[model samples]
Target chain A: MTELRLMWRNTRMVVLCAISAALYAAVLVPFKVVPLIPGVTELRPANAIPIVCSFLFGPAAAWGSAIGNMIGDFFGGVSPGDLFGFFANLFYGFIPYKIWEIISRGEGPVIRSPWIAVKYFAACLAASVLCADFVGWGDNLLALRPFSLLGNVIIFNNMASAMLLSPFILAAVYPRVRRGRMLYEELMPEIKPAPMPRKTLGLALLVAGEVGAWITGNLLSTGYWTPGFLPAWMAAAPYDKSVAMIVSPFMLLAVVGLCLM
Target chain B: MKTTLYIERDSFVHRLHPTAKVFGLFVVFWSIYWVDNPLALMPLALIVLAIALMMGAWENVYRFRWFFILIIVPTMLTWMLFYRVGKPLITLPPFYVSEASLMFGFGRGLKVGALVLASVLFLSGTKVEELAVGLSRLGLPYRLGFTITLAFRLVPLFMESALTVVDAQRLRGYDFDAGGPFERIRRYVPVVVPVFMGALRKANNMAMALEARGFGRTHRPTSFIEYRMHPRDAAAFAFLLALGAVSFWIYYSGLGAIPTG
Candidate 1:
């Protein structure tokens, strides 16, 4: 909520938002030709923009990415896809910043070592999984596409393209941004402190539940799993339904646990 | 800077309110997906194309001719080979493309083409300032609307800056195209890093400029422009609403389903 408030109170953040959106669209619009999956997904190095911007500019990047995607859609053979595209992109641009606080553990972004590189990689993977899952589900609802294909394609495309390019970009630009004193931590001085243990545990459980649900849902929908793959107690129940039933409890527990904390 | 998509033309489409055009876009987008029959999809595609032609968007469409062919051709082939369910007409060792799938793919291609045409028409017809006015009137905060408009305005500036960075890197003896894929990507680091740092500097200067102009002093800033709904705009909205209702009815009734037998 403070992030939202800061966007409104600090006029500078609004300018940052505009810059993020423009940069995103500029990267995306030109690359519309490089479609990896044709009508479903594309070769978007533009994916790197959101991940990079989120780290540098913070929550304003989320709003900027969402709006920029809508505009970029106009030039990229526009579709109702933006209905999901907007939210998926918001996640793409927002999650890294939000997760960075948790993953970085009160430290600023630095990649002078292998361990720090792994942390950034994990955060990128998590963001990619979440965004792809949401977009895959939405595509099924709106376009009657099966879930497995879009899910995997988006996950591969976004994760591979963004991750492959982002660390290099991050490493190259971070020092300069830090020197300019324009990094998000510098711009927004009232950064939140490290999370409490309860919050951390809850977040971990929530992420696990969602990722588990995504994998199980895809496997079940595609009929790729065998009964022998499941335990006897769970084999009789349909995998999709059973996975949802079991994992959803963890999601509920996460929310309740976070609230109590 | 060459920023906007708007083309100078006097036509019915160019005269409508931006909100009405946005609504029309929504109607077209949703309805296109609801159609399941290849034959039924053709008319919808034609309707969109005809509108674009009437609006003098043929020149703009011609500019993207190669893009359309490249995207739509592969999209059609992909669906035919991998997606549509039917007896195989053409089979390779691991893949089959069926007759039903071909038409199905063609229908999907048409849907994509229609959408691209609709978006081109929308962008070419609506000015950025008018879009901002329409968004503000549609209940978005004027400040956020201003940010989106500013983003649109800045897109060309950023693109120019990106080009300049690339040129500067080339002058420094960095061969952007000389190496294999990975090495070429590595070479781009110099270009991307500098452009991003330049952007951060520009953002800081922009923030100072906005502060100097007393931007955030008032909670509600007054705008010099306003969008009003004319009678024609109201009629356009009514037509779009009716189209949406009919499309939904057809979808729910399965009136547009392809006959399998």
Candidate 2:
């Protein structure tokens, strides 16, 4: 609530949000032609923008990422399920800053140590999985494609790009911003802590959810079980197989994310 | 070379109200999904193509023809293979092209084609400012619209500066091309960091400038321009609504379902 108030009341935050979204979109638009799954997925190096900017500008970056992704989708070719993309990207952008605050213990977000790097990477994976799940469910709801396929593809694409690029981006930006005394922490007279407890239950739920996905994926793959509730289109061939293949990595990531938290 | 998605044209499509175009985009996309028959999907592709032809998007289409060959074509082929089920059309020793696969493939393909065509037509014909105006008319707060439009305006500027940053790095003997994937990504650190910092500084300056000019000083702000619905826009909206209704009716009536056998 305070974050929204800060964004709305402060002219600086509003401009920052606009800049973050525009810059994020601008960086991403050129990559529109490179299709990972044609209409379904693309090589989005711009995912790094939210990961980096969230740490730098907080909620402004989060809103910017959501709006920017929607704008980018418009330029790239807006499709039916892109409404999901908008909301999914909102989580993608917002989660990192909050996670960073929890992990950083108010020392601020800089990946100077191995532990910090692990936390940052874990945050990236968690954000990617969450975004992918949201987007995948949206696709299924709209009958755009099978949810599992879209989810796996989105997760792989976003995680790969963010992991590959964010560290370098953060390493580069941190020192310079600090030198200029322009870091988000520096600009604000007081920093509000994120919503409480930060660790126990949320981390536990995330682990349990990912473990469940792993189990479901394995069962579907082995043909030992098939979910009766899913529609024929969604439960059809190759989706179950693909989901099985994809879940292991996410489960591994869940463990890593749990440790980071 | 300056990269731009918008094509310069003065066609009737360009003259249509931006709000109508934005709304019509959703209607058309929704209509696309209700279609499951391959043959029935052709008209959707054709309508968008005809609009593209009128808007002179063919040249841009030709220039980006690789997108169709590389992305769209492969996507169609993949769907055909995966959904193979009906009477065989062609046989390779181990695989058969069947009616169900062909129909399903073409349907998905045409949907993608129509999506791409519509995006090209709309984006080429419309300006970002007009999009913001359309959004505002649709009841988005003027401040939000201004922020979005402002973001759009900044995209080109940021892209240009990012390129400049890349050029500067190249001048510093940075070897971005010779490395393995990870190494190459690491090389981008030099490029992305400076660009991000530059953007941050620019954002700060822009905020100050906007604040000085009375940005966010009021709860409601007046705009110098407004978009009024024209007779043509009304006709366009009616046409879209009618088409969308018919499509939904056809889908519910089972006329557009793909036959498996």
Candidate 3:
């Protein structure tokens, strides 16, 4: 009951985390637009979102984000892997949450303790990469076919990807979240009669969603040339996915409603 | 490329119970594997294709039909010509085309190609939300079911955002119009780094939004969309199940003949 009240008290913060997680999952459709490069990989970013979600929001958040991203996978026409689909994302996507869980238990926050973040970072990174690779390899082994070396190729590439990517999601947003938590503590000292403007709230959500999406789209693809083709091969590898891209709007809106929390 | 299994339209395949069709697909696929003779596979493929076509995916077929034809013809030719290991039906010195090989090749090609088509037809024809709902009805947790539905909606949204991100970079005088593929990739570094960071921010926000809406605990959701089982759906399920049984029997009993022997 106390934890529930605490969640209710910081409901706004938690809800934002969920929405962020949903949008994190939501965008990234694999629609086969022009690629910026010829052979550059895309899946790493897809893996990042859920990890980030789990890191910030807690266990429920982690699972929520993974389920969201999986939906995108389903629609993007992921058919061949069969039941392997169930845990494929879980193995790769659950790393950051686990790491964050460990980190959160330390003396201070993950950001202040950069070494704390780094301590298990390598193991976490290696674990996720290997988990993903083994799943792929297992699929081939089951099929009684020659194994693919592509898994190793991907693992090698992700080293730079992790070093470059993980910090920002870990550092910037998380601190803001912690600060936001601080703000939540400051503002909602007790549940006062806060003016709940339903219409105003709806319009705010609309504007925020559109504007946030526009900024994200424009900010990410800063100009590179690739000739457009009809059969646009989807080039998004793994790292580019997020929460907004996947989970249901009804659920998301509810989370958004919690921002009213 | 991510697989394309959805077939877009309001036909029987579109309307059939999502669970049944999922099972139906599995049944058809196993039948493809079970039938020892390749000749028997074609009819099963044809039946799936017919269902997909009847479901209103004619346009998608026209779009990918050439690609399919190209793949099937070449594979058939290669299998019959190169993998020929038996007594020659037609010999060219060291290279010989045997009756068994030819039959095997055709059967393999037809089965594989038809399976591919069946998959494409399924994805292109099916509405993603309906599929999620069906899964939920089939006993997927409602939370997970809704997550799948939301993620489906997000794919296109993100695809569009990715493009918009590219254009935003172009306007900022980012050298998208760079020479050589490598140069273009370097240019996209600026684009990708930020788009990715921005997406994380979005996910964080989305998670928070969802949690705010009284989402964590079980609350009776006011579902805005509804799908009900109808007579047409029942009939399709019964007929397809029967067809699947027949296919299974034929494959196992070897009543189905292949042209090879």
Candidate 4:
């Protein structure tokens, strides 16, 4: 998180951020022709760029992901919900490298072994779930879209690209980026890892919060589970109030956990 | 490839200060967010339509005609499935189409559509540099703004580079469209790798160029383009405030909500 702020001070990180964002928007704009859900979202192979950039550029990638998505939205159309979309994408790009750092210990994201592959999948899933939860929560709260619709679709969309496309891209480019001394670790050696105990706790909290929000958001939005505690007025269809009340704490937990990390 | 939705124009909307335009965008979204009834959303839609016509932005609107339809139609259908209330006019297994549900669905669709249309109107009239300046006027960090403008500039270059790579690959008889969806996506691996590597090769030199020019020497770098607030900007701000107020008043009066029961 500190790196997110400090990266702006370095000219190289700023340029890297621009490059990452440009690369993402470049891929994103052309793929608008392939709609997955027809206007709600598309078959975004560009989703892979964030994860790939995350492993390579770290904090710059996070900002890049946010900006790139904004650029994409600008092309299609934008709404108030896109403000949330922006942050959701920020975490989408941020979580991968951060989570990988915690889970991979010293392993690169090139996916050399079965264990590393599993870890890679886990990292992608965590990033995807949190990204989905944030967008779902925000849209539902605004009564723009049901949580279940966006929540499930985004997870599938992100994971598909992360799993299918990111590995090959990273494999092809990571060695070159590392050799060029452009990897975030090489460029920003000043950033230190959090203590293992704190980061582990952060990972636990992040996973708990994200997964909890995802399930709870789906159930509430689909009207599968209505809590006894909510007033009747809050338990109606659209479920915006219900979602705001129930899912927000879990989202907060994830943010807090991310901060701790 | 055309990277932005901005139409070259010198209409009053186009001449407005970037901050005013940015504020106008926020005001439109705020107004739309408080209303869920299609009829209530109609006024905002009409206003956006009027602006588009005034700005001669039909090209961008026509470009996104299918997208607008896609957004409204699918949203209506999805909401119809979830919003079950009132006397059922038609029951189709999992979906109930009642007056209440129909109104709710249509309202949601219109809301989403109007939001997109408003953004389209904004982008049509405002340039990328104007957007960055507007956002900066609204308190965005200078570096972040620079990054955004820089990313906007880079997207088309990257897209052009990607096309060149695609052309080279096609010449070698690589079939991109001949595979299943997953395999088709995998084919992009070759296309992405070269563009990615090419982008990374520039990052080091780009960073060096920025530092050489003393990019971060001052917290508030002087802009080459200056925007002074005019009387029209004040009037625009007042009108936007009124728009936001009227929409909130519609909600406060219970006129913007879908009728239920």
Candidate whose lDDT is highest:
4
What is the per-residue lDDT of model 1 for residues A178-247, given as tens digits with 9 covering 90 to 100?
7877776677788564456755774576477447647754764354553465564353212334334443
Q: What does candidate 2 score on TM? A: 0.85
Candidate 2 residues lying further than 4 Å off, grouped into runs, are: A1-6, A31-44, A178-182, A185-195, A198-200, A206-225, A229-261, B1-4, B80-97
TM-score of chain B of each: 0.88, 0.87, 0.75, 0.98
Best by TM-score: 4
DockQ measured for candidate 3: 0.08
Residue pairs whose backbone atoms clash in candidate 2: none
Could you give me the TM-score of model 1 versus the true structure?
A: 0.85
Residue-level lDDT tens digits of model 2 in A63-164:
788889877876656676778788777777766776666666665566678888788887777677777766665654453454555667777777766778
Give the candidate number with the greatest DockQ.
Answer: 4
Docking category of candidate 3? incorrect
Chain A: TM-score in each model: 0.80, 0.76, 0.48, 0.98
Give a tens-digit lDDT track for model 4, residues A134-245. Answer: 9989999988899999999999989988988899999999988888888899889999989989998999999999999998999999899999999988989889999999
DockQ of 2: 0.43
Tens-digit lDDT track of model 4 for B49-135: 888998899888888888889999989888887777789987686877999988998899889999999999999999999999999
Q: For each candidate, C-alpha RMSD in Å?
A: 4.8, 4.8, 15.2, 1.0
Please say which candidate is ahead in lDDT: 1 or 4: 4
Given candidate 4, what's the lDDT at residue B1? 75
DockQ in order: 0.36, 0.43, 0.08, 0.82
lDDT of each: 0.68, 0.69, 0.47, 0.91
Give me the runs in candidate 1 sitting further than 4 Å from their true place.
Answer: A1-5, A31-35, A38-42, A144-146, A190-194, A220-261, B1-4, B81-100, B217-220
Task: For candidate 3, give the lDDT of residue A32.
Answer: 21
